[model samples]
Target: MGRLGRQDVAIPDRPSVGYSLLNMAPKHVVVIIPVFRDYDRARQTVAAILRCSVPSPFSVRVHVVDDGSGDGTAERLSEQFGGRIEIIGLPENLGRSAARNAGATNISADLLLFVDADCEPSDDRFLAAHLLSIREADVSMGVVEGQDDGFWHAYQQAARVRRDRLARRTFVAHFTTQNVMIDARLFNSVGGFDEAFKGYGFEDRDLAIRLARAGARFTIAPGARVIHRDTLDLAQVCRKMGEAGATTSQIFASRYPFEYRTLGYEAIDGQRHPWRGVLAKLLWPVFQPWTQHDAWLQWRLVPFKLRAGIVRIMVAVSYLRGTLRRHR
Candidate 1:
């Protein structure tokens, strides 16, 4: 019931006042969660952030960007949090890149935190962790840990962990956009997220890669974690994979030409189980144009069966287009 600081937000009781003050700082962190269609999940994410047990030397101004959601997400947010949380409702459906840019444009904070609507910050120190990292680096990546007990969840978690491992080691450039913190000044200087990446995939990776290439200091904050609720059904998964395939080629060609040229997509073929690789190759034609395909291929160096077929088709199309252009 006790209001903490000028924000007038209630801070939960703690036995040790000094411990509560450990992570709190004078400057506040602005957290932005971009939402499109998932109102329920987005609302839950904001609630989780509000409930987080972080210290409170300063209060955080959380922004929920509802990117033209048909769901009453904006109304619910206003009714529930009202002045405590700010809601930005877009008239049209701008993709994640655009929504994030809009959210960042309105936020004036010492540090900016970008998180997906489906993810929740792990603990109070999550913001402090980012601040520490930002003091030394322009951008910092937080780990998105998923609980894997059920069969489907286990499978997905295994695959994601593999992707994270690759990101930490060889492909550090492709950090997950689910939970990341960036210096507001540097983000603006880089022109923010590229709105050209209209789809779901590659936009975050593109931004990070570009920043690193431009000599922006990049580092990982292992302690700052977020849990991503990636509960996509088979059909939804395939649809997302298809979108990945479509955007990945463009992403790769623009960002990692050397990697593409050197190892090619063939690099991931032998890394995973034989059946999974074979199955992916078999489905390539069905899922190739999707964004996830590009991600899977880039990190795993293997192809989904349907996506591979689509990629071949796309390759043929590109070849034909190139020939026509040369002729003209």
Candidate 2:
């Protein structure tokens, strides 16, 4: 394994690499993938990147950060790819933001492409598209195409609506770290993602907000598409939305008061809705039991429209409850 000549920093319980040598061409980029307890998916993503063909004047190095999976994810990656890819195993689960920050800290590449473990590029031109986009925009956000299922189809449809709604806005409130290419300088300028956002949700949006504030232009690079291997069942989808909704008060509300108020949540006014809270509590037991059912079975039983409606209500109520709780 060849090591780049850069400063070595220790990451507790893991081997550290020196900074990337500056001598490489300007387009030399490092693809950082952060994984937690999903070795197989990570392997596939890495393999896809390695398989992808990039045009000349652009080179790539891959670094996989195992966020304390303790599941031998690091070893499995090493066994499979050997020295072709670098694996950094954290001592404990530090969440996505921390894992990505750690990965960025180790590399000295001018351009950093952050790809989630569960996302694999759709074609060989994925990297090339992102690299080309960086010439015009500071942040090139790629689209994430999910698997062909009712849930994913519904999710995509909803996303289209939001995009249409915000089509004319200066900064559309949408950003996904699932597939994004950012200049290393711009990434560090905004201080990267907020580590405080520990769990599933607005970390990406938060970063985008900060980037926008810093005058970083974000452009869509549809050609740099990736297929997200992981898809949620009705229950999983509800749970994730609820989890994300919960963070609204702490992260979004305080940072973007205008957008927070626009979302129509009472929490923005520092008011608590006791009835909504109680209602959410009552409905919990009913929905709680359903989360355990097989996802495929849930899809089979519920029509797409009905399921979509239910999910929207669940997420909204869950978000309301979260906001109300914070105010209380």
Candidate 3:
């Protein structure tokens, strides 16, 4: 996901063919999975990772940070995994970034791996592939494949298509914490994820920028893929994009103004393009509902391109309206 804008992150130059093996593959990895209210999903993910055919099972420790679920999740996991996994139950919800930071405390592992609760590895060799990737770079980010096909799945799969053109090793500019590993010391130095980012979007990229600036090499672990179990519709995606614009986008805009402009967010700036806000305001009511349901997602009566165009317009409207509302 290295989305380096023309003037965004500037990673240090690497030798030809990208990665220069940093060091011999190390042992001891801490896999951190942050869980919210989904105990069953979290349980399955932990079980899957534990079952993976890692080189050294004793060297790897799995830590689950139950983010204020307040349920019996911790106890259940303890009962199931026994001494195999550790559970850190937070008192209250600290959001994604803070929960991850909580999980990173007092780590004894040389490598810190982060995987989302909603995702599980494709196969048992997943852990081994990540371990091998760290031989070439400071950070190793695995790929993601969507499950239970839909528009959201297609969108995620399509977004990954850009990776085919990217080198196996590059900067972490295009990163997703869903399934990634980083050097333990390197992660601590960067101060982990910014807790200021309250919602989705930009948080991973922000962390990537800091890591890249700190001279961290990132490797794309294509073989260590994870299956994203969450199914999404147009409405959920739009809601998230809108929330991102209102919350994370503001923080990002303040921090990286130029890069924000490069992402085409400037087009939605109501202060400059007032007409976009006006147009968005008019269409949001009608198109927003269309985005909110799977019924309209059906292209039986409509051309596929036409449906896609409408979805894009509504998503842009959602984001634009969010930015405008936040600014106002």
Q: Candidate 3 residues 1-328, lDDT tens each?
A: 2333333355545422233345434568899999998888888899899888877532788999999988788888889998999999999988999989889998776789999999988899899899877776778889888995655565565556544433233343347899999887778888999999878788877887777766676778888989998877787888888888777888887777665665566677554578988988898878865765667666457766566667767778888877776754
RMSD per candidate (Å) reads 12.1, 9.2, 3.6
- Tell me, by TM-score, which candidate is best: 3
What tens-digit string does per-residue lDDT give for candidate 1 at 122-152?
Answer: 6766776766565555567787876443433
User: What does the lDDT come to for candidate 2?
Assistant: 0.71
lDDT of 2 by residue, 199-282 (tens): 677688678766655555566787999988986665676666566656545676577655444444444222355676777777
Model 1 TM-score is 0.69
Error at 258, model 3, angstroms: 3.8
- Give the clash count for each candidate: 32, 1, 2
Candidate scoring better on lDDT of 2 and 3:
3
Cα deviation in Å at residue 228, candidate 3? Answer: 0.8
For model 3, the stretches where C-alpha displacement exceeds 4 angstroms are: 1-8, 14-25, 56-58, 162-173, 269-272, 300-303
For model 2, how big is the CA root-mean-square deviation?
A: 9.2
At residue 291, give the lDDT of candidate 2.
Answer: 56
